[model samples]
Target chain A: MHTTLAWIDYLIMVIYFAFVLGIGFALKRFMKTSTDFFLSGRSIPAWVAGLAFISANLGAQEVIGMAASGAKYGISTAHFYWLGAIPAMVFVGLFMMPFYYGSRARSVPEYLRLRFDEKTRGLNAISFAAMTIFSSGASMYAMAKLIGVLHIFDPVVHALGLPTGYVFHLSILVSAVITLGYVYLGGLTSAIYNEVLQFFLIVAGFFPLVWLGLKNVGGWEGLIAKCPPGFGHAWKGMTNADTNPLGVEWFALAMGLGFVLSFGYWCTDFLVVQRAMAADSMTSARRTPLIAALPKMAFPFLVILPGLIAVALPTPTAVEAPTSASASVVEADALGHGLIPAKVKTDGSIERDSAGQPVLDYDLAIPKLLLHYFPAGLLGLGLTALLASFMSGMAGNITAFNTVWTFDIYQAYIKPEASDKHYLRMGHFATLFGTAISIAAAYVVASYNNIMELLQLVFAFVNAPLLGTFLLGMFWKRATANGAFFGLLSGIGAAAVHHGVSLPAGSVPGVKGAWINRGAEFVANLAGWSPRLPFHAYRNEMAQNFWTAIWAFGVCFVVTIVVSLATKPRPDEELKGLVYSLTKHDVEHGLPWYRKPEVLGVAVVLMSIALNVIFR
Target chain B: MNLDIRVPIGLLFLSLGGLLTGYGVVTHFTSPEIYAQSLDVNVNFWWGLAMLAFGAGMLHYGRRAVARSTAAVGAE
Candidate 1:
């Protein structure tokens, strides 16, 4: 599919880039100290913080992945928003924000150091820093790859007579430079402000696409009529893994994604929590994530509905293949499901099948809809919004990386007694270093199959068991520092081992497959052990991820509890403001009914329940 | 005192809204072909107006907040 952007579209995108850079330069005066640079001086208002909180998490993977899932899996993809996000967001706002904000920890890893011990803090800090860099790299890779696939810049390149070969590398370099410039100027505050702007732009960009698509498809009723059975329901075939598009049981969805992954990300991931922690007051900090939940719940309509509507539209005859070294044509099967992969020609268009039908690429659902539905000026706005989302995600990662690197790694380990100005300078250097590393990481991410699935797998390996350690440390005073650290290590090890042993048939590359096969044979021959472990066979990679997280969480929880019981624990006095039981309960009775976190949390939960019931 | 974000955000939106609205009006009578893809809805015009109104409200609130804080400081 060729991009449909005109000169007007290019103009709009230029204006957006100007506004983003303008905001960064405008906010440079505020960054007089490290606190302001990293945390916005902890004085951002709740609404601004709330929008930025959600927007920072909205990256290239989220926008493209959700739409792709909507087209592939139908309405069940809303589970990522409603079930996987809202509840955890509410829990963080109502219950977890006090420790995160009240204790005045510089970062999440700092909180771990306070609550657990040095080793626990060290593990979390190093892993979190690495994850942020990797995540940033992934976002960069996704944006460059997406721009290449959509050929959005083809017109400009052709007009300028530039070579088409360097488009992907150019996209990466341009985006990296833009992000680095702004982040270097205003730091986290710049990232946060840009994220808020991006949130508005994204809403404005996609609302029209959804409206036009729905109108063309004859509304919700038309969508239900055109799509396959069970496509309209969120929980219909969820009870049985084999019957659903997700191909995962309801238990795994609830326990693994809903409980482990959601809480791990929402509560502990510094990328998002840092936004809320920048709120002006305790009440605002507590309310920040709750306010974010409102938009989070509504995002399925903006992002996911376009994909569903794209699928409901009449099937297209021709499609473009992904621009990889091995470009493959994707063809539809007997039931109109496109999964078969064929070779493609060098010109980027799909090679026709034996029946003379051009293969369709479902991942292009949103971009194709933008091309088909939006007008000229609005198309520019939509493309700008897409670019804004990518930049916002990368900026968030870079900002988080700089903060963690400066405070957790440099301040704590490199120079513990550094002055504020010294750390602030270090933050600037870290931003540059982190951006360079992320560019390298983006190059490394060329091999990944699906952006969203890869992210989920990463979360399973890192965040799942980390959630268990945090859960025990916060509520249970008996949890020892040694227990938490070792438990986390074992949990990550469990996820890796599960992935290694359950290696899906023919999924591994040739070299890795040969080595793994040899290792399996040696183990079986030496110990008389079966090559395969006794685990339930999953239908999809997502299901495998869910099971891996579930097992990891169980192992972490059990190991932490057992080791804590066996070891000595920290005294209660030492745990004040760190442990829930030891901390004082500060109630805000003066606030109005709606301003209260519990009130809003309950409402958010009720709304989520209503959504589930409506689509069940 | 810290600068309120609303002022800058409001100004940015107001500028964008003005640009879009002006373009929409210029193109409405002269060139209808520009909006042929969106069913001739003139989306830029209506959305621009909505943004202008929102931006104005934010600017008003931000100014009032600044006034109140300045008055308190003078009283102190």
Candidate 2:
């Protein structure tokens, strides 16, 4: 399990750590008020906010998960970037930023309060705060497990005379301390600044790996030749869910991912929106997501290309993996696609499917490729880049949690009016506790992985409903508070019921779904149902996923409209800046043609469409 | 607030690039076989050079920005 690391690699990691901490110390003097600590005094540049916006999402799971998707689904995985995030990012910048920035609300949940009611804000604040800490913990657990698996710290373990098992504990402790140190010292400003630096470092590290890999795989032509049909294409075979690589047809893909999931996340998730909220002016805030969209669209080449390359290359029976995290012994050729290792169980044996074929640990695609190609010095840089992403993501989650807890939960509910200095102190205190709980949650994840998965699934179900609530609250002044509150609850309930009857093709009728099999169908039959049941087993989990989103959003959209017409509407005068139609839409008037978000929005969409065509 | 972000990023990468290039030079003379694993391309040297160029650009741009802001403040 030992991965080779030269002195140069250790030095590289140390220097990176020093730079992060130094940035924190340098920004410490500016934290005299809670506004500075939590919001960066709204003085950040658009580009910096933009980079942080993307970097906040560049967690270990995201990088690994995207690559895994690339390995499993081929170039179609880019659809997640091109179709899923880019449009939502543009919409948030051009359309949503006016309400978010103009309203003097400090947090997303705070905005909910101004637009809707305190009850709605409280519901969102509590759930968001809880999700961030646990998600951060889950990511922390993943990072520590990765460090332990890679055995990069074997020499340090030997030098310190610690047991091999303690490496995991040490990794967790070190990450927590480093993350807490910078965040506590300088708060949101430090996190945002470090994220921008990490953005460059990530590019520096991965760009080379991809270059070497493309060369190894004999360039684009060779990759196309080596891959299976449609592996290199984004739009091929997308008409039918059964044939589509993503197992969801075009309309569901467009509506479910492109609209519901994308807007739900990019527009409402405070983790990224907070970065934009830190911008110096309304114009910068409007530009933040747009600027982020440019790099974001190009990231598939950086992150997803490695997986495509890994599959195209052949596996050496026994790869002398330089940074071997998995067993060096390769399985039968019938088992694996390429250099990607077979999924191993807790007992350290390869996991095989019901078909007797080995299921690849697609998550290890990036790790194996890094080990297969990188030498010592450059290897260090790559691993450091990976570690930087994990830390950055952790810090992103904590920063968001603290703000929500401080402003939405604490300031709103606990102590209605605290002094500026007292609130600043509370911000630091929140960071400390948020991180501590994350550490504890990391241990909980290590023990009860299933519960964590279920929790994440529940969290996913809760997310798509948010965009429905936000869309109504922001665009429609006639949308009532009661409508929003009840509509959100109905959307979540619909997602649950949708999951109740549906199941992915192969999976059993359990937590994966179809738990309500016999009774609902029997009842429907007794009632002499006119048409076929739409909520039956889907082609795959992805098919079920897209439908679930559509169901939730569809339900919330109708319910909110129905309820709004029945209930009393808030006065239009009180909703000036918070409602889109009421806000000043021509604020971009003086900006040059190139600077306007609408122009950039069009250009970004066109570029992404070109990418879809090129890959297709 | 005064600390421009590009300065730290520039300085960090500058040192990192310098380290890699220096090490690459020493290894090219001392242990030539180390480059074999990385497809014999001296990634440390070439990529280090690329990073060095980028780092210096960031540093120069950041310094000019800081200077301009300071000059504006002084004028006021």
| DockQ computed for model 1 against the true two-chain complex using alpha carbons | 0.45
lDDT of 2 by residue, A1-616 (tens): 1366899999999999999999999999999999999999999999999999999988865677677777777888888789989999999998898888888688999999999999989988998998888878887887787676566787798789998888888988998899999999999999999899989999998999889988987898887778767778888888888776778889988888788877888899999999999999989999999999999999999988888887887865555433344453344322567767665565767777677777676766777788777877788889888888888989999999999999999999999787988889899999999999999989877432222223335445777888899998989889999899888889988998888889877666667887677456667889997434444878866667778888998898899889999998888889988888777676566889999878899999999999988988
TM-score of chain B of 1: 0.91
Model 1: how far residue B54 lies from native, Å = 3.2
Candidate 2 docking classification: medium
- Candidate 1 docking category? acceptable
Task: Give the per-residue lDDT of model 1 (tens digit) for A1-616.
Answer: 2244666678777877887888788888879899999998988889989999999999977897888788878899899889989999999898889998988998999999988888888898899899989999999888787677666786666777778756788889999999998999988888888898889888878888898888877899998788777789999978898788888899999998888888888888999999998899999999999999999999999998887887787653334433322223223312233221222345745545457765444556677678666766677777888888899999999999999999888888889997899999999999999999999999988544457878888888889999999889888988999899989999998887666555333344221123345566667879876574333345767777888888889899999999999999898988888778988989997888878899999999999999999988
What's the CA error at residue A464 for candidate 1, in Å? 0.5
Q: Which stretches of candidate 1 lie over 4 Å from their true place?
A: A1-4, A158-161, A318-361, A503-536, B26-31, B70-75
B1-76: candidate 2 lDDT, tens digit per residue:
6799999999999999998898888889998787876788899888888889999999999999999999999999
Candidate 2 ranges beyond 4 A from true positions: A319-335, A446-459, A515-535
Name the 10 consecutive residues with the lowest summed lDDT in model 2 chain A.
Answer: A447-456
